[model samples]
Target: MQTKGSLVGDLVKGGIAGVAGTWVMGQVTGYMWEHEDPAARQRYEEVTGGKYVPDRTAEKIGQILGLNLSEEQHSMLAQASHWGLGAGVSAAYALLRRRYATADAAQGLLFGLLFWAIVDEGMTPLFGLAEMPQVYPWQAHARGFVGHLVFGVVAETVLDVFDQAS
Candidate 1:
């Protein structure tokens, strides 16, 4: 049973962990993308309309708000949205961890899978932020899965460190 202060502390730690996880996930996915076969990558780009999902989402949001953002502004907004989602979701994961010790089982692998399925496989397409999951090349799906797995592991490890230091 966490006190209010402890809950706040947990959330802070989780946000930091999430930022770290997001950075690492980006690196891993970037590497995968760079090494992906040209034809497959081109196919993915074609099906997904050639822009990164976050960028597309940002553009759509800007349009909705009637803000004519420059390209740089759009890029910044896209990055902010990406990191914000990572931190926000990870903070929720931390709360879940507080209630259920089992939530940390497999070093957050299940949490990662749930995140991938709910956000990547389901919500993004449902919300029109991304193309349907089936339209992507298998490699894209593989990269997303691996990246989330890494995110879960990294976030859990950081939280463990925080626990040890406290």
Candidate 2:
């Protein structure tokens, strides 16, 4: 069992590392999204019976708040959501690490997959922000999986650095 101080250290260190990892993830996914296979969108529509609009979550959030935002605003909101989700996941991971003594990479990978399943496949659809994951093309799914894997690896690396420093 970790003492209270060590637990706090984990929270701080993990949070910092997570945010860093998320930034890296964004950079990676941003490039992939820009260069994504154009045909993937058609496949997604065929599978999901819907259009694949990026950052629909931001639009939904705006609708919920009775606010209308321009394209630029939506883009900003999407960025915010990306960062917020990353930070939130990292913080949760920090706390979870307290109970489990697994290797960082393994734990991070599991966390990434769980986050994808819960957010991409489950919550997004449940909240009407996105179509179910089944509707997405294999290319889209692969891109997301790879992006999250990067996040996990980066997060674990940073966390290890912090652990060593402390």
Candidate 3:
């Protein structure tokens, strides 16, 4: 069991790892998008209306807060929301890892899949933050899955590094 200080340290490390993982995931997905079938990519763009889900989420948040956000503000908020979610989720994952060794069994691959399923395939649509999974092409799902797998692996690796350093 980790002492309180070590747990906090782990959480901080997890947040850093999450940020790193998210950045790498974005790069991977962007590359996939660039190389994707034109037809499928066009279909995805059409279905998504060229707007990012995080942008939609930011807009919705602004509405709830009764604040009218400018386009620039919306974009900034969307970015912040994206990074914040990544960090927050990974921090929670760190806590889980400390409590249950099994959580680290697959070097975070299972956690990544679960995160993708629960957040991407489930909660986003359930909360009206994104379209239903069926609306997207198989390639989109595949890209997301691959990106998340990378995220899991990268996060786990970073956490391992932290462990070794400690």
Best by TM-score: 3
**Per-residue lDDT tens digits of candidate 3, residues 1-166?**
2323477788898899899889999999999999999999999999888877798889889999999999899999999989888888888888777876453438589878888898888988897888999999999999999888888878877877776676
lDDT of 2 by residue, 39-92 (tens): 886676576554333477787789899989998998889878867777767777
Go through the candidates in order and give each one's C-alpha lDDT: 0.84, 0.74, 0.84
Task: Compose the digit string of candidate 1's lDDT tens values, residues 55-110.
Answer: 88898889999999998999999998899888988888877778765534385787
Candidate 1: which stretches are off by over 4 Å?
1-5, 103-107
TM-score of 2: 0.78
The pairs that clash in candidate 1 are none
Q: Show the lowest summed lDDT stretch of 10 residues, model 1.
A: 1-10
TM agreement with the true structure for every prediction: 0.91, 0.78, 0.93
Error of 2 at 39 (Å): 2.2
The candidate with the higher lDDT, 2 or 3, is 3
lDDT of prediction 2: 0.74
Question: How well does candidate 1 score on lDDT at residue 109?
Answer: 81
Clashes of 1: 0
